[model samples]
Target: MVAPGTLLLLGPLLAALPGLGQGQGQGQGRQRRPPPTQSPLEKVAAQEELSLPQLAGKWFLVGMASHCSYLAEHSHQLEATAVTVTVLDGQSLAISTFRKLDGMCWEIRQRYLPAQAHGRFLLKGRGYGSKVDVVVGETDHSSYAILYYQKGRSISVKLYGRTIRVSDAVVDKFEQRVSAVGLSEDMTYYFPTYGFCDSADEFHILDETKP
Candidate 1:
């Protein structure tokens, strides 16, 4: 079962959409602000080595356990969630996320910078309340992989593969990493494997470029 409250991770960003910001509408005034945030998610240590070439290109987002209502307009069976990481220069990667936000398909781009570790990096993007540290799990750079992101009050764990469907052993590895990060069983949500990412009209890319 999907934990409905996982949408909090996607909160402020989506709320910044038109007519969606905190208290910026007509007739809705004097509203109190949200309380200070202390997230349970802590950054995971980065690995010693990362292959930029092997990590490049598009990868299917098979699963996620986070506080993000990215698919609010559709069900788990509607479409697919995915991303493309283009290796820029030598150390950085251009990450483009394709997901549903505020009732529409959105493509958000952000530059990922190398942090204090080889496998860890800071997300150089706006809209997020703070720096998002992305940690990569075990990978051969060819098949299945796992990604963990933590920042502010958000914890995002994602499973990716060369294709939409993966082996049970692959999913098992992902589940292990999810637990390693302190995500309980109730926080997991597996996006259905509908193979809808290839649908032309189902997704339209938008450039939310950060300056």
Candidate 2:
């Protein structure tokens, strides 16, 4: 029972209405500081001198923390998710996420275009679709990865493991990052260890590819 809010890996970018207003409105006769040039998500540093090839392989989506209302309400119905990352043309990433929706395995494909920064990427939506900024905050190239996704002002942090289970130390690190982003432990949800789907048939694939 996936939430109508979650489009699997796409998160709120695919479900929520486009152009939702963000930032605090300035009241009449009240002075407000100018906004920073970069967003809060952009301020978070990416893995320095990241090697994209090392990130290629199957990874289990073990943890996620987001403030999307639908996900917050239906967090318990989260499904087991897995992703296979492939480096395309030596820079960009071709990602295929597998999960079960209504008991049927499905594949969701996405491409992360490299940004000016080494570990930062961008997922541009098609047509009226919204854009998502992606950053690999931390990764050891073997054991675990902590990634951040932001669309507009909403941000979601994800913890990926080389295997289904990661060490408690890693979980602690993930929680710390989550809290740093103003979210609490209650907003974090862990995926199931079992019932992971390796692949999905062609008919069940949702390709978010650029023409």
TM-score of 1: 0.67
Which pairs of residues have clashing backbones in candidate 1? 6-67, 6-68, 7-67
Per model, how many backbone clashes are there? 3, 0
What is the C-alpha lDDT profile of model 2 across 77-155, one tens digit per residue? 8999999999999999999999999999999999999988889999976765478999999999899999999997789
**Stretches of candidate 1 above 4 Å error?**
1-43, 67-78, 99-105, 128-130, 198-204
RMSD of each: 12.8, 10.3
For each candidate, the alpha-carbon lDDT, in order, equals: 0.70, 0.89
The reply for model 2, stretches above 4 Å from the true place, is: 1-37
Q: Pick the TM-score winner.
A: 2
lDDT of 2: 0.89
